[model samples]
Target: MCATLVGGMDRLKREYINAAKANGVELKVFTGKENCISEKMGQTELVIVFTNKVSHAARKEVMHYAKSRNIPVRLVHNCGVSSLRQNLATN
Candidate 1:
């Protein structure tokens, strides 16, 4: 499955990708600092957002984009690798 992750610690980006890979998911992560976040989240099967780390505008955009496309969004406040795996496993 393909997943897009927004927020989470920038230092753990590689770990996040590895964790997703271990779960058999292809994950694209955005730290919320970049421009055009919603546009970059292309064709994902799932949208995982770290609520505590992401900016309000970025979160809003992600929600809108995912809703419009009928894609599932998972909100994780903790933003840990373990939490990511858990969310990915759930669906």
Candidate 2:
């Protein structure tokens, strides 16, 4: 499965990707500081937003884009690797 992660610590980006990969997910991560995130995030099956770490504008933009495309969006308040892994495991 493929997923796009919005927000979370930039330093832990590698760890996040690794964790997702371990669970058979191809993860693309955006640290919420990039410009035009919606455009940059290519085709993805799931959109995971770290609500606590992401800017309101970025979150809104991602959510809007995901909704329009009919993609599943998961909002996680805790921006931890474990939290992400847990969510992915369920799906």
Counting clashing residue pairs in each candidate, in order, gives 0, 0
Which ten residues in a row are the worst by lDDT in model 2? 33-42
Q: Candidate 1 lDDT, tens digit per residue, 1-91?
A: 8999999999999999999999899999999887889889889999999999999999999999999999999888998999998998898
Point out where model 2 deviates above 4 Å: none
Model 1 TM-score is: 0.97
- The best candidate by TM-score is 2
Residue 60 alpha-carbon offset, candidate 1, angstroms:
0.3
- Which digits, one per residue and each the tens of the lDDT, describe model 2 over residues 12-70? 99999999999999999999989899999899999999999999999999999999999
Q: Per-candidate TM vs. native?
A: 0.97, 0.98
Error of 2 at 84 (Å): 0.6
